[model samples]
Each structure stands twice: as C-alpha cells, then as structure tokens.
Target chain A: MSEKLATAPRGKVSLFGVLRSESIRFFSLNSTRILILLAIVLYAAIAAIGTWGIGSLRASMGGMEQMPGMEDLAAPGFASELMGSGLVFSQLILGVLGVLLFSGEFTTGSAVSTFLASPQRLRVLAAKTILITVVTAGVQIVSSLLAFAISKPIADNYQMDLDFGSDAFQRVLWYGALAVAMAALIGLALGMMLRNSAGGITSLAALFFVLPIILSILTSITDWAQHIAKFTPDQLGMALATPSSVVTDLESWQQLLGVAGWIVLPLALGAVLLAKRDIK
Target chain B: MIQAQQLTKKYGGKTVVDNASFTVQQGMVTGFLGPNGAGKSTTMRMIVGLAAPTSGEVLVNGRDFKKSRHPLTEVGTLLEAKSVHKSLTPLAHLRAMAATAGLPVSRVHEVLEVTGLSSVQRKKVGGFSLGMGQRLGIATALLGDPQVLILDEPVNGLDPEGVAWVRNLARQQAAEGKTVFISSHLMSEMAQTADHLIVIGRGRIMADAPISEFIDNGLDQTIVRSADIEVLMNALNGDGVQLRRIDEHGVEVTGPDSVTIGRRALEYGVVLSELRPLQRTLEDAYMELTRDAVEYHSSNVAETGGGK
Candidate 1:
C-alpha cells in the first residue's frame, strides 16, 4: 500500500493538468458531443438548402431581367457563397453548448469537485475558456468546409462563379469563425454569471433573439437607435460574416471593432466574477 | 494534522462560525459532532479553502490549504455525496481528478474496486443510488491517497454494510498514522468510530476531548428496583445521592454507583429485587451537552397546546 501510494505525485497543481482534466470532463458528456454534432449538421444542411434555393431563383430571374438589382443578384455559383449561410444558427447552437459547459457545473454541484481539484479558481476558468473556444472553432471550421464541398456542384449547375480564394470567401471563413467564437465566449460569460442552465440559456436567447428584434423595431422608429442596433452581437456577427452588396456608411474596420467589443466586454466581466465569487 | 486558529466566518452581519479554535492530530479518528446549523460544514469548507474565512485561518499540515499547490495529495475531502456531474460516469470523474494530481489511471480503477463501485463504474452518476453516490464520493477522495481525510456525513445514506465498511476504513486510515476527521450528527456512529471527539453546538465548541472523557463528563446514574421501593428510596437518601421515582417499583438514582447502593441495601437488610448500573451512552452525553445549544427550536405547540 505504501509503495502504491509512493507512485502518486504530490503538489503544485499545474495549469496544463487542470486544462487536460477540464477538457476530458467537457468531452466525456453526451450532451456536449450531441450539441457539437447538431451545430455542425445544422450548419451544413442549412447552407446546402440555401444554395439550392438561391441558385434556382437566380436562374429564373435571369430570363425576366426586369427586376431591380437582378444583375447584382446573378453572381455565378452563388450557391458556393451560401456555404456559410447557417453561421448564425451554428453560433446559437454552439453558444448554448458553451453556456451548458460552465452553468451545468453549478447546476449539478460539480463545481465543488472541479474547484477542489484545482483550488486556483482562475486556472479552472481559464482551462474551461480555452477548451470551449478551441472546440467551438474546430466545429465551425469543419461545418463550413463540408457545406462548401456539398454546395459547389449545385453552384456549378446554376453557372454561378464560386471562388474559394476570393477576399469575400476568405472573410466568410475567418470572420465567420470569429463570430461563432464570440458568441461562445459570451455564452461562457453568461454561464458563469447566471450559474444556471435554464437561466443562462434563456438569457442568451433574449440577447441573441429578442433583443435584436426589439432593437430593430426601435431603430425603425428612432434614428439614434440604429447605432445601438449596429453594435448588437447579432448584427456585428452578421455584418462581419456576410458582407451585403448594399453599402453602408460604416467602414470595414468599424464593423470589426464592433465584433471585437462584443467578445471582449462580456468575457472580461465574466472572468472577474469567476475569480471573485465562491464556487457553490 | 489540521489546526484552526481563531477561525471565524460571517455571512453579512451574522457570524456563522465564531472565533473558534481546535487542533485535529494525526493517528486518530477525530469525530466532529455538532447539531445542525452549528457551522460544522462551514468550518470544514473553510479548512478546505472552499469557503473563505472572514478572519483568521485554518492550516492543514502547517500551511493554509489555499496556498498549497498539491492540495489533493495533502488533504482528501468528501464534502458531499454526488458533487459530480450527473452526465459523467464515476470512472470519467475519477480519471479526470486523478489526471490533475498526475496520478495514473490505474488509481481510478483501484479506488473504484476499493469503494465497491467497479460494477457501476461505467454507469452515469445521475442514475446512481444514494449508497452508490456515497461510494463514488469516497472513491474520489481516495484517488489521491492523501494523508488527511475529511468526510462530512459520509455514512448518511449507507446501509448497515456500508456503515461497517466506513467504520473500518476510518480506523484503518488512522491506524496508518493518517489524520481522519469525520463529522456526523449520529452520536452512535461517532461513538463507535471516533477516538477523539470534538462536539460543536450552536456555532460554538461544547466539548473537545477523548470519547471516554466525554462519557465520563456526564453524570453517573444507577437504576434500582424493589417491591418495597419506598424503603430502598429512604435508605438511598443522602446529601450525595439523589433519587427519582421512575415508577411504582423502580427508582433512578444519581451520584452513587450500583455497588454502593447494593452494599447500603444489604447492610440495611432490605431484600434486593434488582440493582443495575445504568451506564450513560454517548448519545446521553451529547444530548446533555447540546440540549441548550440546539439552534432551531421547533415549537411542539400542536401536541402540547391541544386540550385534553
């Protein structure tokens, strides 16, 4: 028994060890795997469906040629460009997954075990943040590539030009991943703040779904509200991922700044709270 | 060993654990006996650094647990049963915890076997019974094979077998010169398991001594029975001996052992019907110590106030 005990290493809880433990626990759950798979499948499926529908519409409008902006809409192989069409839905799904990662710990009373293993509370939080960000980013990228592959032939059938190397496509890939990452971080923050699954997810939904709709309505009535709506996470993520042909007054840098702000503010607040509050 | 120096915890303006101090030495199973709301859990949490003390400090192995780098190897705590994710199997949870201390995965299986959780190692903890959950909790605590073990209500939901297993485990761990600090509201269980007893009541230390000392501190009493009970009562009457009539045939006497009572009765030529020494149990000692310290006084108004 003493020799068996001698094999157990003592002292100094390393961040790397904590991160590994957190990652294993995060992935071992069925819910986490299901959420990631659902996000990926939904992202790819929505992209393929959107491509087929848009391809048909473009073909039909080509013969008429009377609709305003018809020529602008007739980009060759627009179907391929639709590969990232489901970025919003993907972000929402993975965002909820992110919320559950931390919030579930508290809801199920696992936070005690987690913190006890690594008493440096911030190290555990950091481990969780890195694990979720990496996993979410990986899922988003894989879904985008799969959607592109499936949508390419359909775009070719409609004679739409789909250039993977184009600046717009690259922006869609990079900014799209960033958008999902931001949503996940925000979800992680909300999880730490609320520390309840239903409460955190509900609050996340209100931020992404209800708040944007209310802001859109308010923007229509008041000119000043438009600026506020532009800064919303949903709007920043959408503008960054899918640049519309219709130009707006804000520069590309300003839209990127909006995305950066959305990611930074909430995450900073959440980190502070995570460090300060007692693990329940 | 665990040492707490003037440990205090305040929630808002209410002081849950006052400036209390005690030391738990190694090589002994120290029982933390306290009534509910006596701050036993809070003090334990503070010692493990889960709850920060408002002032003062608790040191495990001569240093604060918060400052210790390898806490799991220093102190193993089973704060509560099922403090794990329901979705995770006991194997995954234990493996993850072991990974933190750089312990091999084999330790996980070893602890599972020891705790009798090998059969349910793959089952989700959400579906586990209370006894199984307690076993899992103990397994996780033993994963690090730490020197000090702190368990709170470890046998709350165990069957007779589990209770016996825990008793043997505690004694075995202490026999190995490891510190075993266990808290339980069950006096009978503590009486059987603990070598040294620390009794807490209403957020204050009531008695901190050996189990034998605790039993000895309470008053000694003897029960006597006689057909001529009135005569025996009269014979036993003295400045030192006090007697209470339990019924028509029996008298409960305090301040005199049964030998003294029997000798007195025999000298008086009174026929001895029954003379027995009534040994005070640990429960009696605990109740006598904590009777005034019970925090929540539920009114028995429904029973006592009803009209006969």
Candidate 2:
C-alpha cells in the first residue's frame, strides 16, 4: 500500500477529458448497447412491415383510381416518408437513452464522484450534451438507412417506386436524424432538470406522445394552435424531414431554425438549473 | 493546507452546519470527530464543493478548489462509499474518473490492487458488501495520487484487519506530507490513527488541538497509591481538590496539575509507592465533551442504560 504509484502523471481536466470519461462510462454499460440495437431493429422491422402491407394493398386494388383511404399510399414520395413511420418509437427509445445519460449520475449518487472529479458543474452538462447529440444523431441516421434498405425491395416488388436519390428521401434521411437528435436533447435536458429517471422519462413521453395529440386537437379549433404546434419538438422534427405532412408553407431553413430552437431552449434551461442546484 | 472560513450551509429553513471554521495542516492525519448528524459529512461535502455552502467559502491549498486546474490531483475525496451507479463495475467507474483527470488506466488498477479490490474489480458494484464498497471507495480516493485526502466515515463498515489497513494508509499518506483529513464518529478509531484531532458537536467546533493535547486538556486527574494512603490523601487535598478513595491503598485526586501534586507528595514524604498521572483515553475526552450532543436519545434512559 505504501509503494509509489507506477502510472504516469495526469494533466488538468479539459473538455476532451470529460468527453472521454462520458464515452467510456456510457459504452461500458450494457443498457446503452441494448437500447441502440433495439432502436435500429425496431425501426427497420416496422418500416418493412408497413411497406409490405401498403404495397400488397395497392397491388390487389385493380385500380381505376377508386381507392379513397389509400391516397397517402399513392404519393410519389410516400415510400421514403413511410421509411420513418417508426421514428416516433426511435425517438422514445433514444430519448430515454439520453435521459439515462444524465439522470443516472444523479440517481446512483455518482454525481458526488463525478462533480468531485471535475468540480465544474456546467462543464459536465456540456460534455453530456455533446455526447448524446453525437450518439443519438448517429444512431438515428443508421436506423433510417437500415429501414429504407429493408423497405425498398418490398415496394419495388409491387411495382411501386422507392427512389433513394429523391429530394424527399434525402430530407427524411438527414433531417430525420436531426429530429431524433432534437428529441434526445430534450430528454437530456429533462433528465438534468429533474435528476430522476422515472420523472424525466415520463415528462419526455408527455412532450412527445401526449402533447402532440393535445396540440393536434387544438389546431382543429384554432389557427393559432397550428402556428405553435409547428415549433414543437415533435412537429419540428417531422416537418423538417417530411415537408409534405405540413398544411402551412414553411421554408426548409425555417423548419431547421425551429428544430434548433427546441433543442437549445430546453438544454439552456437545464444547464442553468444544474449550475444552481446542489448535488445530493 | 485546507481551510474553511465560516463555512455555513443551510437546507431549507434548517441550518446543518453553522459558521464552521478550521484549518487542517499538512504532514499529519487530522481526525474530524463528531456525533451522528453533527455536520461532519456536510462539512466534508463542502470541502470538495459537492454541497454548496449557503455562505462563506472553503479553500484547498489557498485557492477555491472548484477553480483548480488539477482538481483530482489536488484533492482525492471519498465523501460516501455509495457514490457510484449500481450497474457499473468498479473498473468502469474508476476508469471514467481517471479519464476525467487525464490519468491512465494503469493508475486505476494500481489503486484497486492497493485497496485490495483487484480480484473483484470487474464485478458489478451493486452486489458489493459493505466492507467491499468501502475498499472501492478508498480505491477511488487513491486514484489521483492526490496531495490532500478527505474521507468521511471511511472505516464505517470495515473488519478489524481492514480497519488496521485504513489506519496505516492514513498515516502513510500523511507521512508523505499530504494533508489527510478523516471524519468518524468512533473515538477509538481516531485515537489510534490521528495525530491531531478537531472535534465538532452540534455543528460547532468543540476542540482543536494535537492528539496529546486533547487527551491532556481534560480535567487533571492523578492516581496515588501508598501503604499510608491517608497521609498522602491529606497532603493532596486542597482548595477545589476532590479526592475519592478507590481502595485501601489508593486514592484518586483531581483539580491540580500532576506536577504540583508530585511536588506536594515529595514534600510530604509519605512513602508513596506509586504517583501516576491518569492519561485520559480519547473516548473519555470525547464522551465528556459531547455528552449533550447525542442525538435521538432513548425516551426512557434508565431502561436502556448499560444494556449494550
């Protein structure tokens, strides 16, 4: 016990240092890998089944343009847009991953060790924000690509067009990742603010699952509700990737800015609370 | 050196630690002794900036610890043994901490081996026993090879052998000139491990002195035994002196210093066989100072008295 430590001396704490710590700690847990795998597989499986069902239905309809409920299935870009039909589930799964990324430290009492190691509270938050952003964005992109790869052949078998290079396909692939990342960032913010896993996940569900339906009902009653709904985390993510879903004409850049606002506001608020509150 | 200048912490409307101030110097183990809920853990938390003090400040080596570039190297703190995620293995936990301080993985294994946790380093911490958790916590405190070590209740769940190891580790670190501050409610543990003792009761500093000075600071009592005990007792008695005859051959004397009583014994020439200064154990001194500080006393004291 009295022997000198043989390891090399360490330098000061930096952003990269904290990031390296968060990455190692994040990956070492089995739950992180399991969540990422489930998100990808669940997204691709849903996309494939939905594409097959729609393709088979369109094939059986001897067609004379007589179908009323299948109007969305007839759109030129419907295949690409349908590839992200499971984005909501991905958002739920990856968003919980983001929540665990921050809330785990508080829940397990490890905030004491983490804050002691770094001492700067806001720096820890900044590192976690970057970590979840990169991870969720990367995971969502892979899940989208996989979903498209699996769903395209089924649509092609039914004489339906599923082009990868279309403008709508590119939007769903790229902006869909951005939207998933937005949901994840919101979850991260909720986790930091609440500092409890159950509370953070429940509130995240309220935001993505409950609030969207509430707003959709209100939009039917008032035009002002539609304006506010467009900027919500769910709507911003959706409209940015699938522009055909919106009734209002929103420029691509404006949708991007809306996504940016949803991501920034919650994180900024969470950071302020993190810096102010004491670590128990 | 570590200093807390009027460090005050209040939670809601309750004051947990009230204007506590002390300086812990380097090159010795300074024991922080207090009763349960006496603000020892709160004070330790403030030192490392884990719990923000409502007012005043705590400094490490003359600067705000939170501003230090090398925080882990400056201070290795173990505020609680359970400061870890339940699902994480000890190896993963220490690796993360080492990475934050830019320390290599080799250092993590070194501390684990030293703390006797290498065999179980990869095991999940959730299933660790109380003593094993403490060893892992100590392993983390040793990870940075820090200059200042602040541990709160480090030996709470250790066996006798593990207890001895902690004592040796504390002394060994202090021998290297690092500032070692350890807190515990057990006086016997502190008595054996600490060189200087700073006692607190009810969030107030009750005593601060060297270990020797603390024991000697209590009422001066001497034991004198002789064939002619009555003659020695008469010579030892004086204003403010209380004498109790313990046996036919011995008497207990208090109020005067041992030197004065020795001189009087020599002057009387009562053929004294033994004139010994009664050295107070740290337990005795601590119990005397904190008699009013035992929180959650039994409602019926007589029923529980001497039951243990």
Candidate that would win on DockQ: 2
Candidate 2 local lDDT, B233-264, one digit each (tens): 88877789999999989888988877887788
Docking level for model 1:
acceptable
Compose the digit string of candidate 2's lDDT tens values, residues A70-104.
Answer: 56666778788878778878888999999999899
- Per-prediction DockQ: 0.46, 0.65
Whose lDDT is greatest here? 2
Query: What residue runs in model 1 are displaced by over 4 Å at the alpha carbon?
Result: A1-7, A63-66, A75-80, A245-249, B225-239, B243-252, B261-271, B298-308
Q: For each candidate, what TM-score against the reference?
A: 0.92, 0.93
**For candidate 1 chain B, which ten residues in a row score worst on lDDT?**
B299-308
Candidate 2: fraction of native contacts reproduced: 0.75
For candidate 1, write residues A1-280 as lDDT tens digits: 1112333556457888888898889889999989999998898889878878877886876653357656555554244457767887888889998899889989999988888888888788788888888889888888888887887787779776667877667767787888898889889989988999999888988988998899889988999888888777777776777766323467889988887787778878888887766666
Looking at model 2 chain A, report the run of 10 residues with the lowest lDDT sum.
A1-10
Tens-digit lDDT string for candidate 1 (B1-308): 99998899889998888887999999999999998889899999999888888888999999888777887888899988989999999989998898777777887888888888888889999998888889898888887888899999999889988888888889988988999999998899899999999998877888889899977865678888888888878988888888999988999999978888888888877777788887888898898899998888776879777656
